[model samples]
Target: MARSGIQYADVQQAIDALLTRGDAPSVQRIREVLGTGSFTTISEHFRHWRNEREQNRDVPPPKGVPEAVATLATDMWRQAQEVANEGLVHYREEANRKVEAAQDEVLQATREAGDAAQRECALAEHLHHREERMEALGAQLADSQAQQSALLARCNNAEQDSAAWAKDVGRLKTRLEQQTSEHAQQRETERGLFGQQLGEEQQRNEATEGKLLALLDSVRQERADDDKAQRKRTQQLQARLESASEEGRESRRELKAAEETQAQWQRRYEQAENEARAQHETVLQHRREAEALHERLLRAERTLDAEREQRIQEADWQVSLSQRLDALQQQVATLPATAPENDDDKPAEDHSDSPPKT
Candidate 1:
């Protein structure tokens, strides 16, 4: 028979075959059928089978064996068993072959299951890594969004500031234009006034130049006349001196009488010369007084011209003021009249209704 502890079903089949053949089976033949080289391994299988049989004693073996087969001899029985064991060994070998095949299939399936579990663990790790990457990307996206919002807000504020500055610039430009126009008008008015003053001053200067030229011509004429009178006086004095020298030479013959007459004539000539000098001084003094009077008249004329210009300016101002006053009076005259209150403290209308006049 195959080893008794080989699968119970397998051992039972071999035992059945031995009983049917009417022979005793040997241990060697059983070992050969079991295909086990180690006695220790066969012993471990028998111990396991004995323990299982004790626990489940009521269950029968898969194949039935007669009780007589257990009592056979050692040597003749071994030989007889060899004949019977031949069929039993073949049956046991077939059964053990099927069991080994099933065990190898189970081992392959277990290895495949372990490989699948390892792949599943690796895929789970990859998924976790991808999730962490996605979280970091999401955080970066959020920060970028916040920064964009801040930039947009700053742009909006800058736009508002630009608009305000533009408004201020426009207001300042308008004021500048108005001021420039007013200044231009004032400058024009001042230019007109200065032109008028320049014309008046030019006229006064021309008049003064004419008077000065006249005065210079009179002085030159006076100097020429004085030079002529001085030459005549000098010729007269030279003639008188020659006559006195001749009379003195003649007087040497009549010394006392001629000397007294010559002295008297010299005294009279000296007195006349002194009187002429006094008259010349008086004429010079009168001429200087006349020149002073002429200068005073020129100054007075200049003052009069200035006064006339001032009067003209005053007249223009008065005329403007009068026109303005007239306009104001006309405005006042055109205004509506106020009503007086009566004894009843109610205002009365003073309307004089008439046909509309053209």
Candidate 2:
């Protein structure tokens, strides 16, 4: 009685046609036409229809039963009951077959549904795991970003410190250069003074040689005059000889004194020359020390410059790292919540392959 739609009417007609043919249609065919796999459902509907028809037959005719036709109605009722019983038996057999087929179909559908549900559950679990992995990667990326920021700050400070050290080194180099120049000038002055003193000593030695030569000529002239005066006065010859001998002795002593004075001057000159040489050597040693100091300062300045450049390079690297971190952060921010799928309902590993933060 609940069968009220066109689809239900069509199914009832199909059932009647199958019954009339004395061969019930296969459940597959019914399912193909009815778009349902349940044989029990089909059998139940047929049972309900047969029961409704039988109930109608069992009901008494509406106010038309007469005694004269009672015997005839009874005979017709017996034959109708026999025919109904045969039809019911045929319906029952068909219902059993349909029920078996429907049960098989339901079981198959249930298995398929179960398999599908299992697959879906597996996929959902896999997606959940992937989401957790992505979340962990994002957290790691955030931590790396934080480290990069701190490193960048430290690098910037190092660069500033290097620049200051470079400036200080530059000032120190300038002062060292000035000191070196003054030392060089002093050495030149010392050399010039030494040369002038040597020239003055040489001139004094030449004048002393000229005075000794004149004194030797005067002694020769006096000896000749003494010989002539002794020949002229025989009586006073002895006295003159005595006087001449005293004069000769005095001249020899004077000559010895002059020679000793000249030797002293020579010794003094040699000492002065040796002192000058020693002073020159000392000055040269000082100059070498100054030069060495200057070289050391230059090397130190170069080292400072190299260190400064290295710090600057490090700073640049830190800046680049910060930029990369910023870019990675931006990319993370723009990532979609739901990952896209391909044919297999699996999310691709796009974000996972991204570079490290910074």
Candidate 3:
């Protein structure tokens, strides 16, 4: 089973937060902040992020050896060329000497063979008249002819050897030319490879720069969204507070009206009590005139008591209503001045779409 990590937006937010805290983001640090990504996945994304950053920035070319070293290399190459040319001249001279020497030996052998033949002819002419001398002259002529045939064979062998040496020299020269061409081609290939590597590095740098710009835009957009949300939440709180203020005003009006009604009832009760007192005084004066009036006076006293009790109950109801109104005003006062739009300060919950950030 594999655990998923946060969404790209969340990861970006985390990175921005880390930057705000002056911390660099690495695979391990990002994972620690996110608390859920696989190490391999984090490593891959981090590599991409770093590449984007590098592309946005300029990268200087790698420093090679100092100018002194380059000068030294040039001098060494020149010396080697000079040395090779000298060796080639020496080799050609040596080969020509060998060929000339071989030809000279062949010519000297030919002249000696001709001289031997002439001397044998002279001996034959001088010895022709004597039979014993003629017999000895025939043996010498046979030996000379054998020696001439051996010399001819030796000359033929020398010619064949000379031809082989010429072919060997020609092949060696061709091989040297091929080696020189191959060395030149090798240097060309090395230059091509270096140029290709440099171009690739430049391309990588450009890509990194583009990515950094995109990330910056994303951060800006997110900030704008946050600000908008805050403004909306503030407006909502203000509207709620206004509604509560209206309700409080309505409650206060009702309370004031109840107090006015209570005062009117109190005035009515006092007027009734005054009337009862006047009737009691008239009853006391009439009791002396008529004993029958005494019963009416007692009934009037009972009616006054019932009316007083009813007024007391009404006053109690008014007081209860006033207290409830006060309580409603307190509740309206206690309402919060502003409501939160979201719990952004707290860590987010894990969901299918996104993981938690630490």
Candidate 4:
């Protein structure tokens, strides 16, 4: 009669198949081969099968069997047992390797999960830092904008002041030109007066010479009678010539002084014009500098805006990474906490004792 367990035949057949194919078999392997038995049931069935084979071998030969035949039969059974034992050892080693590999895989998975968590934390920290940087950049940009506004206002004021200064310069030039014209007219008037005075003096000198010539003729005609009168007239004519020469020299000196005064006025006018030009040039230089500063500010603002946009993009990417990390964390949380049912019913793997012999 068969031992307990309806799967005994199935287990025996699975073992037989493994032996035919030169494969080591175990309770776990038998379950794998059958695809539908628990380890406890399969191990029980395998033990029963081993017992039946051993019992059949131990049955004494009937009707005086030959000693050589019995010895040969025993030898064959021993060799079979040895082969089965060797196969079992190889199967146990293979099972141990598989278990270790499974443990290693579990460890690897745990490490990967840990690494993922660490990465998520790092990403969160980095995101926070990015947000802070973005805030700082925003503040900086606001400050820059305020500064730009102030600078623009200052530039506008400078431009207005420059315009006012230029207008003042133009007004001054106009006034100076008017003064110069008036001064020139006055100088012409003085020159005309001096010329008239000189002409009158020349006319008086010519009249005196004519009168002296007439007196000389009279003295010559009178001879000794008018000698005293002629001498007195000659002395008066000599004094008159001396006085006219002195007046002409004084007029020449006055004209020379007037020319010098005109020259001084011209130099002053030229100096004022040069000073005005220098002021205008200075204003132009200031305007150029302001323009350059404004241009640089514009470029910096553009750069800041671009960086702000890039930071925004990075912030969005970080958020996506955070979402992925959340999903991963959830998956890790859902992992199984227990081993498989087959592992629970697994047969003893460390025993080296062979099956009981007949």
Candidate no. 3 TM-score? 0.20
Query: Candidate 3 at 311: error in angstroms?
Result: 99
Q: Model 3: which residue pairs collide?
A: 52-208, 55-205, 55-208, 55-209, 56-208, 56-209
Give each model a TM-score: 0.33, 0.35, 0.20, 0.40
Summarize candidate 2's per-residue lDDT along 1-358 as a digit string, tens digits.
Answer: 3333335455566654543433333333444556753554554454454455444544554455465455444444344444545555565566556556556655555565566557556655655665575566556556655655554565555555545655655565565456545545654554465456446545644664465466557766775664465355443545644665565566556556555655655565456456545655655565555556556555655655665565566556556555555554454443332111010111111222211111
Instruction: Give the alpha carbon lDDT tens digit for every residue of 1-358 in model 1.
Output: 4334456455444433543454443334335556653444443343344355345544443334443433331233345434444545555565556556555555555555455556546655655665565566556555645655564565556556555655655565565556556555655665565566557656755775576577766767686775576567557656855665565454444444444655655565456456545655655565555556556555655655665565566556556555555554444443322111010111111121211110
* Alpha carbon lDDT of each predicted model: 0.48, 0.50, 0.50, 0.60
**lDDT at 164 for candidate 1?**
61
Question: TM-score of the candidate numbered 4?
Answer: 0.40
Expressed as tens digits, the lDDT of each residue in 266-341 for candidate 4 is: 6665665666566556656655665665576567557656766766776676566666656555544443221223
Tell me the lDDT of candidate 3: 0.50
Cα lDDT of model 1 overall? 0.48
Q: Give the best candidate by lDDT.
A: 4
- For each of the candidates, the C-alpha root-mean-square deviation to the true structure, in angstroms, is 56.7, 25.9, 85.9, 10.9
| Two-way lDDT contest, 2 vs 4, winner | 4
Counting clashing residue pairs in each candidate, in order, gives: 1, 1, 6, 0
RMSD of 4: 10.9
lDDT of 3 by residue, 119-179 (tens): 5455444333343544554455555556555644654554455455446545644654565
